[model samples]
Target: MKSIAVKNIKGRPARSVILVVISMLLTFAIFGGTMVISSLDSGLSALENRLGADIMVVPFEATTQKKFDDIVLQNAPGYFYMDNARVQQVLEREGIAQASEQFFLASASASCCSVAVQIIGYDPETDFTITPWIKKSYSDSLGELDVVVGNDLNAFVGDTISFYGVDCKVAAKLDKTGTGFDTAVFTTKDTIKRLIQSSVDLGMNIFGKVDPENTVSCIMINAAAGFTPEEVVNDINLHVKNVKAIQSKELISGVSDSLGGVSGIIRVLICAVWILGVVILLLAFTMSVNERRKEFAVLRVAGAARSRLAGIVLGEALMICIIGSILGVLLGFAVILPFNGVIEQALGLPFLLPGAGRCAGYALASLLLCTLSGTLAAAVSALRISRIDTGVILRGDN
Candidate 1:
């Protein structure tokens, strides 16, 4: 009986083609939106993990006026060297957990094969953010005039490069972080000082290459468990005059803000697509229900209970929802497969394989929602058939 009902449902134009299209559209919109948001969030999470620093302490003058801009916009404007003693002072504070200092150096044609590479110099013993990841790849301790390159630095592991006339060995390659770290190289504080010493003839116009007397470009602070980043920033501001502390979230928000109108437009477009998909689905369900009233009324006359008639209608809707959702998922994956490189290039980040369990849950939940919505809409028309006078339905007056 169910087979005959399914076949009859399929034979009707409203149940066959339009229903499938609606399911395809609804699934595509929902899943596609999910993928895009997940991509953005994953990229952001990767970046935050790489930074690892809870608070960023830059020059006191730079923090008040757009913190990130002051640090990265132009080296000269953002450049202010706080006393290494002051860095230690912040460390000694009660709420402070740990701190590591780093300086950014930009090198052009550091080697014949590699182009410009940004170098971040850290004190190995004090630096905690990236050392763990780097140590995992290369067990050897980083030495003076030795460095590890980022995955996207356009150089390979074990390569050698000359920086400020000092030869440095590329000990290992860091993991792909999908952030600025991908374009940076890491080295020890001693190596950075030696490079600055070797570049005495450059006359102080360099982006990095600081004197040995100075400790670092910025101090990374990790607050104790009970302490909040904002409270620490406020404390630092009150006690320390020449240093600025920035929270990690503020830093990310700053970066997102710099993305300008493009991100906003993308969000708006995603919303519009969602609305259109829902409208298509509602229209498809309503039309299918309208065209099936006569058939449903006949089922009612043949001693089929109203519940049974409703079930047949709902079963057809479920079939359309399930088939359309599966096809949409497959199609969405196909679209994502070819665009891996494009996504990486556009975001300066690579995508991760979504968790199989999570994706399965998404698919199952989406189909359930779609099927339920269709069933409810069809149920209304089914109930209307139940309201018909039995004598009239028998007399073919549906």
Candidate 2:
């Protein structure tokens, strides 16, 4: 019976190809859309956990042209300076529990590659934000000239990265954080100071005679018990001079909103494709069955049962769905896995693909859905073909 179904499909190559293409499109829509949505959702969650701060404080100039937002959310390389003393001032404000200062510098080319990345200098003793991830890979104190690279960076522990002729040894590499910051290079305040001095010596004019030791780039603060991040931010903005303070959520809101929009569009496209594919497939099967009425009647006269006729119709659909599903899934994997970075850059959102188990689940789910849609679309035609007036179709009677 299956062989007969296969023979029937091979008998008409064009119609079979069209049906297979429809099934392929259906599977591709489901798998591709779900993968994108899943990656964005997971990436945002990781960024939230990695931030671990209530408020961010930076020199008011960093807010100019949305420079700071670009630096934090998109990892666009730029830097501004504020007096390091502001860290203590912010920490002393009411509703502030703890604060740590960080310094920033931009390298046009990290020694290992020509890609630009941010160099962040954090206080080793007072920091809360960068420490959690750092401890996962390294526990020893970061010596001067020792640096920790983010997971997205090409450098590994034991590799040396140079900045403006200053070489810093990579002491550790932090795990993936699923944010643009993953490309940043982290180091002690002393190490970044050295890099700053090196750039100054090379006449790079990055600092313009500003004393590097007395300046830090930004501050990350945690609000005290019973104090919200909003309260802390407001207090700092009101009390501090020449610096801007903002709640952490404000920095992430843009990403959240973008993710929501992208995910919505993907889902809509998936639904639209699924509906259209089913309609086209149903029409194709019905028209093909109609064109083969006399062929079915001849087989019935040769002792084929009605159930056997229906099975052949469904079997052809099942074969198309299985082949199409395999092809679609392979195509999805080829594009999504290799080009995830390009997708992230294009969408301007961090993207971290789901783990192995989740990917397998999605693949299996899409395959099953494609198969169900195929068989169901053919069902109506199968029923009609099985119940035909074979005597009329065969005997040449009106």
Candidate 3:
């Protein structure tokens, strides 16, 4: 019976290929859509976790010169100075719990083709944001002039990278945070201040007249118990001088909404392709069944049972669906896994692929769902052919 089904599919080469393509489309949509949506979700969650702080305070000019999202969430290379005294001022505000200041400077444009990147300086003794990630890579306190590179940075542990003629040893490489933090470099406040001084000496001063001794680029703060982040943010904005205080959620809400919108569009597209594929496969199977009525009648006359005839039809569908589904999954892996970084840049969102086991599960689920749809599409045609009168079909009597 299986051999007969194979022969039938082999004989109608073009029709069989069309049906296979339909099944492939179905699987491809499912696989690709699931992966993209999952990656976006993971990235957003990681961004939120890595931030840790409930609020961010930056120089007012920093907000005007560049959006906060571009400066931190997008890792756009930039530097701005706010009086480091503002940190103490913000800490004095009501409802402020824990706070840490970070200094920022864009890396000098290398003589080579390298573009500028952000250099962030955090106070290790006072920081809660980056310490968690740093601990995962290196438990020891960072030595003077030692820096932790982001996961996506080219330099690795023990490698020395230079900024403004000030070379620093890479003590650790942070795990992927799936945020802009993945690309910027991290270091202690003292080291970053040294880099700032070196930049001034080298005539690459980005913050002209801004005293490195008294400057900080941003402040991260967590709200005290019984105080909401919004209330804390408002308190800081009202009390802190020359600074813009923003709730963390307000900063990331744009990104979260963008992810949601992208995910919804992909889901709609996946459903549209899936439904269209099933419809096309059904029509193709019906047409094929009608064309082969006489062939089936011949088999019926040769003592093939109705159940066997139906089995042959379903077997052909199963074979095409299985083959097509595998091809689709392989294609998805080739395109999505290798080009994920490009996708991330294009979408302007944090994107991290799900783990191997989860990806494998998605592939399997896609294959199963597509195959089921294909088989069901052929089932009605199979039943109709089996119920037709053998003699009438053979005699060309209808």
Candidate 4:
């Protein structure tokens, strides 16, 4: 039976190839669209985990709200400072479990640093955010003049990075967060203080006189259990001065809204492609079976059962679907893995590919769906042919 199905497929090379190519295209659309959406979802979740803060307190006089939003959501780098006193005040607020001050310093140019990147300074003693993430790579505290570069940065551990004549060793490298952290550099408060002083002494004070000891770029806060982020934000706004408290969810909401539109478009496209593929395959099978009526009649006269005739038709479609889906899945991975960086830049969204096991599972599911659709498209033609009168077909009647 399988041999007969193979012979039938081989008899019409052009039609068979066309059906296979169509199946491949349909599979590609399904797999590619699904993987991209999955990656985006995973990336956003990772960014939330990396932040692990209920609210971010930036100076009230800092850049406009729009610019600040771009910094956190779009990974745009910028620097501003406010009095460190705000950090202490935020900590003393009701429902605040922990708060840490962070300092920001931007390298003037590539000449001033290994790369043009934002420098973030954190207090290890009070930090509850970056420290825990960094501990995954390095357990010890970041010593004086030691830094941890972001995953996107070119520097690696043990490499020395210079900023305005102040050299700091890269003690560790952080994992990618698909956010500004990927392009920023992190170090202890003492290291940033030295960098600021060095810039002043060397007459390269591009950021003006930065009093590292009394200035802070932002404060990260974690709320106590049973206290919501909105409540924490409201409490901070009421009691804290010269700073703005932004909830993490507030920042993520805008991005999520934008993603909703993109996801909708992708789903529509997937559905359209699937429908078109099924229609075309059904027509192809119907035409092919019409031309093979005499052949099916001959087989039936030779003692071949009607069920066997139907199975042969389905077997041909199954073969094409299996081969096409495998090729399509490989093509999807080829395009997605190599050009992921380009895709992320073009989309301007967080993206994290699924691991090997999950990707394999997705591929298997796609293959099964494609095969089922292909088989169903051929089923009507198969059934019609199986019920044809053997005598009329053998007589060459219309």
lDDT agreement with native, every candidate = 0.66, 0.85, 0.86, 0.82
Query: In candidate 4, what are the lDDT values of residues 135-203, reduced to their tens digit?
Result: 988899878899998888899998988898778899999876666677788888888878877776776
250-283 in candidate 2: lDDT tens per residue? 8889888989999999999999998998898899
* Candidate 2 to truth, TM: 0.92
- Any runs in candidate 4 off by more than 4 Å, and if so which? 63-66, 199-207, 396-398
Clashing pairs in 2: none
Clashes of each: 0, 0, 0, 0
Task: State the lDDT of candidate 3 residue by residue for 6-114, as single tens digits.
Answer: 9988888998888877788789889999999999999999888877899999888788884567886766788888885777788788887889989998886765213
Runs with alpha carbons beyond 4 Å of true place in candidate 1: 5-15, 42-44, 61-95, 109-113, 135-140, 143-146, 149-178, 192-209, 212-215, 224-241, 253-279, 297-305, 336-357, 385-398
The digit string of per-residue lDDT tens for model 1 on 1-398 reads 45745786567865576777777666766675566555555556776676788888877765555534523421212234566777776776667788888766555553422446666778888888868778877888987788998776666766778766667898898776555566677888888767556654454325344556665678888988899888888898788768777887787775555433444665677567656665666566556656656666667777878778766766776777677777777776777546754765675433433556766676666666655655565566556655656565556642
Worst 10 residues of 4 by lDDT: 70-79
Give the TM-score comparing model 1 with the true structure, all chains together.
Answer: 0.72
Top TM-score model: 3
Residue 105 deviation, candidate 1, in Å?
A: 1.5
